[model samples]
Target: MKEPYEKPLIKKVQVGLSNKFGSVYGRHLRPEIDGVPISDLVSRFGSPLFVFSERRLREKYRQIYQMFSTRYPNVQFSWSYKTNYLDAICAILHQEGETAEVVSEFEYEKARRLGVPGSEIIFNGPYKPLSALKTAVQEGAIINIDHFDEIYDLEEIAEELGQPIKVGIRLNMDTGISPQWTRFGFNLESGQALDAAKRLVSGGKLILNGLHCHLGTFLLEPRAYAKAIEKMVDFAYELEDNFDLKIEYLDIGGGFPSRNRLKGIYLSPEVAVPPLEDFAEAICDTLLSKLKPNDFPKLILETGRAIVDEAGFLITTVHASKRLPDGTRSYVVDAGVNILFTAFWYNFKIELEEDISGPAEPCVIYGPLCMNIDVVAENVQLPPLPRGTRLIFSPVGAYNVTQWMQFIRYRPAVVLVGEDGQVDVIREAENLNDVVDRERLPERLILKKS
Candidate 1:
């Protein structure tokens, strides 16, 4: 067999570059996932399928839990439901002794459905409506008040229930993060957090038992956590001195990053992202040093991406190839931003299904969406592979499933690959009925044909 011919062009070659497709060839050409062939998955589940490694998911949860548990005396991990709240994913973490961390009433109900007791749930996020607050208060869920309004709502709920409700106030501080996430919680530097604490104490209906703060997401610096912990601990001591509030816990909210490299990050994830060990050391060292030997509060981590990102993969097929007016090669794939929503931020690791031996060129990978922003990757090096060639995109297990939208095309099916090489469909692919199930046709608009 002869190789496909190409219109050759002159270009400068980079030093030490290999015949591989991309500079990230180390992660290129994944023909299989967890001993299951990509073709087999696509054939059974169809293209643009989402595959998860149950083994990797369990391993990540254990690894992070162990890292922090060994360093801190009482460390609790709360699985962030907003990350990937699929029952399958959540069940896996819950089975690993993780408590549920929900941001809304819907998530709270999901956790409860999974048999997570209300007392075991950590409720975070802004905009908890009256109904949500009422349910949370009655269920004994650990509620973190995000604003003064939520504080007021909870107090009313506590009074209505005729009981003392324990609550935590979310704080935002200048952890040296620019464009800081000051939107969610009370500000510590401006004394907003202290003021909120006073409100909780004076109100008498709510008890301030915990202190919570989430600096930002995709955090690369472990020292940032150390600083946040220091502030939170200091605030706890202040509460104890002035309001006699012995803070029961410190909820260091999750922002730990996955191995996926950010868009503007100059260094690779291996060098740019600090290891979990560094984070555990930074947080635990600060906690142990500040509190007394027996007075250390429960340290809770709400990590999401770091634990599940690497465990997910998306299998897409090349639908068509085109040469742009600028002579750049591009491909139209089945998966798009609608399902791979993180594509807007993360440039996932792209690999071919099989080895395509040819001169590689820089090309663009586009999704099936008609929108201009439906690009999967740009200027990625790849060989000129024909249509129907499957490509694997990975580390997409974090937010895609939760944040994905049902747009012009149907969302694909999701499968979980077990440790013994068995496969199970966790989510079925969407169909016309699934899309139009809730839609209703007006009586006047109904058409009758002969």
Candidate 2:
């Protein structure tokens, strides 16, 4: 009889960096999520499923809320819809007393359908069509004006409606951050922000109720927010003195960094990112010192990723394994960049569902797409994972669902595990009809096979 079959293996000399640098296993353990085993979840929901923890979501929201509210009076949080707009996730935050912060008309409509009052919604972003504006205005939404055209449009709308409309001016300032986000709002350094405020207040068509500025996304430095708050408060005081306007709220747009390691980062996220309380202290310290006790404006934060990223997980299964010509191990998984868009920039934390002991080797994880750019992780240290091994990719709740692409594969179902450990499908998995239903072919093309 022939010798027992064994998978081909290569023995190579260890060189250069040690395995400890690249290997993430043995240090991190992932046996279950919310007391639900990974195998059970895969069996029940199918492989390549997106799982969200309602308990973690509520915990993070409460943690962040307490961190800020305890430091600053009149603190409010608006769930950033662009981060993760899953109805269940949004509902959880809304239930925790968080308002809705939407960017597009679709998000605005979703908030409304979710029973979020228009007045409680903060309608943001650069593009606001006339119809959306009309709806938002009539619904009592707080619109943050982006550019001069918006000011003129709002003035026209106010004139047409025969009443002065309240709006916030998004001011762009140099907060000493790299690649400044100056494209969205009026430049404060150039006095354009002051000019816009004057245009709104002096014109008597629009009322400037709030001041808003978004520094940048995934900001590693809390001091940047300190700078932003300082400038925003100074501008608010100037507006009150010169324009006789009482700014109702100071909206500091979301830039809080999440606990996800970037692709090029060498240190882990737990080592790199500042704690949530640190950010709170930085912001609150600035606000408390800058504003007088009687003039403290309502502090509104639009934090999204920092609040939800850690609460989500992506469970994928290994479909196949192979060795490259150079004896490098490679894993082909059921999910890829199509669903995990953040994989392009983040080296997401991945964990094996079961414990196994073996010599760890450099591995590249690829998605089940025909494209070559669908790599999920590169040069990660992992032992050989045979076919069907489950891998959990985590801190994925922020942008994956909202930014996922519908190319090649239909998106997977998203399930939310409630606090009581009950699993519910928040978003149904897409099927062939889901893709074809929205697509139309002309009658002539349908009749003739071209």
TM-score of each: 0.96, 0.95
- TM-score, cand. 2 vs. native: 0.95
TM-score of 1: 0.96
Each candidate's lDDT (Cα)?
0.89, 0.90
Q: Write the per-residue lDDT of candidate 1 for residues 58-141, one digit (tens) a residue.
A: 998999999998888889999999999999999999999999999988999999998999999998989898998888788889
Tens-place lDDT per residue, model 2, 1-450, is 674464677667353454544534443468789998888888888979999999999999999999999999889999999999999999999999999999999999999999999999999999999889988998899999999899888888888889889999998898888989999999999999999988887788898989998988998988899999999999999998998889999999898988899866777788888898998999999999999777778999999999999999999999988778877789999999999999999988888888666677678999999999999999776776777888899899999999998999999999998999999999999999999998989877877558
Runs of candidate 2 with Cα error greater than 4 angstroms are: 1-27, 447-450
List runs of model 1 lying over 4 Å from the truth: 1-27
Model 1 lDDT, residue 431, Cα: 94
